[model samples]
Target chain A: MSLINSTATEALDLLAKGQITSVALTSAYLQRIADTDDQIGAFLRVDADAALARAAQIDQRRQAKQPLGKLAGLPVAVKDVLCDSQTQTTCGSQMLASYRPPYDATVVARLKSADAVLLGRTNMDEFAMGGSTENSAFQLTRNPWDLNRTPGGSSGGAAACVAAGMTPLSIGSDTGGSIRQPAGLCGVVGLKPTYGRVSRYGLVAFASSLDQVGPLAANTTDAALLLEAIAGHDTQDATSLDAPVPRFSAEIDRPLTGLRIGVVREHFTTGLDGEIEHAVRRALDVYQSQGATIKEISLPHSKYAVATYYVIAPSEASSNLARYDGVHYGHRTDRAELLDELATEQKELESAGDREALKNIDNGLVRMYRRSRAEGFGPEVKRRIMLGAYALSAGYYDAYYLKGLKVRRLIRQDFDAAFQQVDLIAGPVTAQAAFKLGEMAGDPLAMYLVDLYTVSANLAGLPGISLPCGFTQSGLPIGLQLQAPPLAEDTLLRGARMYEQATEWHKKKVPI
Target chain B: MAITRADVEKVALLARLQLTDGELKMMTTDLSQIVTYVDLLAEVDTEGVEPMAHAVEVSNVFAEDEVRPSLPREQALANAPGRNERGYLVPPVLGG
Candidate 1:
């Protein structure tokens, strides 16, 4: 296999036997990124000098017979949402365009401890707010399969880089369908670990209750390896599960006998493209041929997933994003004249000892907060903030945000009941293959509908994986999503692997 | 409830975002449509259901009150757009 196309697992084997050096592997990927990233727009920044330097250090450690971590010498790309002090962590927004975190996110710290070569930061939706990477304030990441279509987002850059062979593995965050949707569209493997399975410390907060970090790779084994390396409890993230981390890569190949896969009756009824439904059915047939039974399950409350997610995610975002008021470490608008006027007024009020009057006057600080955010955030971000504020506002809280939460309980109940009969749930990751770049640009609601089948997993806090099942007639790849009960990542990966082994979809390379 | 231009303006102010006239118009239309779409949730029978604030059941993750090393003042101030020798500089808050 070409060095650029080798999976992380394959490259690791070569490094272990001394047949190849980390420098050679890292350089190949760096070179590939330099050549193709201009067209794909998958990466926001590539630190060639830093990556080469790290690769050399790992090579020397190996030569001296020093012990290495699980992902020693492999190159990994991280979504810009994860903080790394060495580079600017722009969460694809101008609000954080120049913000460099003082410390590494727990996941980035873990990757460093594993001795993985940090290649670069990939692009994402601004604050992970949009379904497509087009919301990125910096650049638009195009699908490698067809440049005219979207790569699926907000982890579009992470999925695109892996699919386009720029990196063997990349880390992505999922709030709703950010990771799985893009991976499905790009014809790669993407896993969204159960909520709390991975720590969210250092991850730029989007929707705190739903955000999760996971891996995107060329195959399930690579995804498993990356997950194993990053999964564990951390003191920094209160939501991080205290349970022991499972060796997912080691257990991935174990065959799952008498697997009961549930197919939701509602997932196929409306807005689903015929080609995607057919492809997912064939994937189910592959499992059936392997002696697995497909059972029809009803998650009746799933129809409300998109509606519930829109309300709940935005409400949390409105509260979490209040900290970026330009007072600390993000974009601050320039209002020199207003500040000067306010300063003069404050001096006069303090000298006169008019404390009550001083407290009532307009300070310009509130105006600064408003203008700075207005200048920093994009249209979709602004819309969501407005929606969220309105939902959580005084009179409307119960009608919107509270109602959404109650419905969320119903959605979880639907999944809990389904899991009683089936070990896993299978469906299409997206309603259709990748859409054209501007197809849903003017319509935010239409764009949200794309996440219809995938949001239920995030809402229910379940582990979901998107595998390359087949392709559309236009050659756009289709993803078959398998969701397991919370913390059942082992079963999720093995189930995905079974279908992967039976089909040749994963072997198909991007035309880029 | 329909989202009028006034509603959008009020929400934007509450969210600390200053939108232009064109943005306000666009947001009014868009938010109205979104609110209408989500109104379907009102039809779901959720009586006696408790509101789920989080996906997982976790609460009061307490840690010992021992002091640990924290970021140096300089490092913390490094990304501040406007900072003085001691701390961040911002527009006057009280009267100034």
Candidate 2:
């Protein structure tokens, strides 16, 4: 097999045996990226020289028989949402187009500590605001399976890079299925660990409460490996769980006898495409025949997950995004231009003898802020900020934002009650397989509704995984979603691994 | 409730964003459709339910209140679109 087709685990085994050097592996990926990135658009930036240097250092350590980190020499791509000291962390937005953070996010730090080569930064939706990477301010990343279709997003580039073999492993932040949605579309394994399971210290905030950093990889085992390397407590993030990190890969091969798999009845309702439902049901059969108990379950309040998430996420976003004015950092307008405009306004007011209007003109700072934000954000971002501002406005607070919060509680309650009956919940990751580009364009609501099956896990702070289940007649991959109770990713991984072994879906290569 | 052009204008002002007349019209329609869809939450009976802010049950996570090394001034200000000796430069808040 070609070097690019090897999974991270397989490559690591070769490196340990001295059969392959880190420099060779990293160079192969860099060369492939140069050759194919224009067609895939998976990468926003690739620092080839830095990557090779890091890989050579790892090789030197190995050749000298010195102690090495767990992921020594592995190349890993990171979503643009995370802060990296070596690259501009744009969060895939024009607002921070030239912005580079001085400090790396905790996850990036951990990747370096593990001796992994920093592959490069990948593209994403502007601030993770949309499901499709089409919301990216840079280039749109196409699904590796079909260039005419989208790689589901805001972590679209993260998943596409893995699917396209540009990188063996990539880390992405999932705020309402950004990681898993794109992973599913691109036919790879994506895991969204329980909220607080992974530190959110360096992640660009979208919906603070729902965001989590997790892994996207070629298979379940590699996904678990990447997750273990990054998951842990950090003092920098207050929400970071203080619990000891579990050896996630240690449990992947364990047999899951008598595991209770709850099939969410609500997930199979109207609008779920027939092929996806069929594939998910077939996956349930694989579990049932393997000594697992399949029970029908219902999360009644999940009907409101999309509605609740929309209101709550945007309300938080409006507040979180307020830091970007033409002041401390990010894009700013020229002061001279603002001053000239201010002079014109003041002269006009003086000629009209309207002294009161001059007081507002004195606040040219506000004018600069307004112009900078208006020019900086894209249409989707501005829409969310407006929605958030309206929802949090004094009179509407109780009706929209507050009510959304209360509904969120009910959604959590629904999950808590269901977990008591089953160990894991199984369902379709998305309503359908990857759709053609521009299929849902012009209607943001249509795009928002596609998140219905995946958002509940995020709303309730549960860990969920999306793995390839089967393919459509047109060769599009379908995903089966398995969600576990809080911090039960080990259980989720074991179940997904069993399905992966019994089926050939994950073995099929992306046509790219 | 249906959002109007006036509501979009008000929200835009509150968000400190200066939307053009064309954008304002488009946003008025878009927000109206989105708000109407999200209005489905009103159908749920959440009476007396406590509002959930964070998904996990976490309280004030405090660290020792001690001074720590911070980012150097240059690195912190590296990404500023406009900066100067004092700090980030901005338009005058006071009339000359």
lDDT of 1 by residue, A138-190 (tens): 99999999999999999999999999999999999999999999999999999
Cα displacement (Å) at residue A261, model 2 = 0.9
Indicate the docking level reached by candidate 1. Answer: medium
Provide the overall lDDT of each model, using Cα atoms, as 2-decimal numbers: 0.92, 0.90
Question: Over the stretch A1-512, how does candidate 2's per-residue lDDT look in tens digits?
Answer: 77888889999999999999999999999988987889989899998999999999999999999998889999999999998888889998889998878888999999999999998999888999888898888888899999999999989999999888899999998889998899999999999999999999988898899999999998999999999999999999999999888898878898788899998888888999999989989999999888899999899998999999999989999999999996877778777876787788889999999978776554788889888898789888998999999999988999999999899999999999999999999998899899988898889999999899889888999999999998899999898899999989889999899889888888888766
Top candidate on DockQ is 2
Worst 10 residues of 1 chain A by lDDT: A335-344
Docking level for model 2: high
Superposition TM-score, candidate 2 onto the true structure: 0.97
**Segments of candidate 1 deviating more than 4 angstroms:** A337-362, B94-96
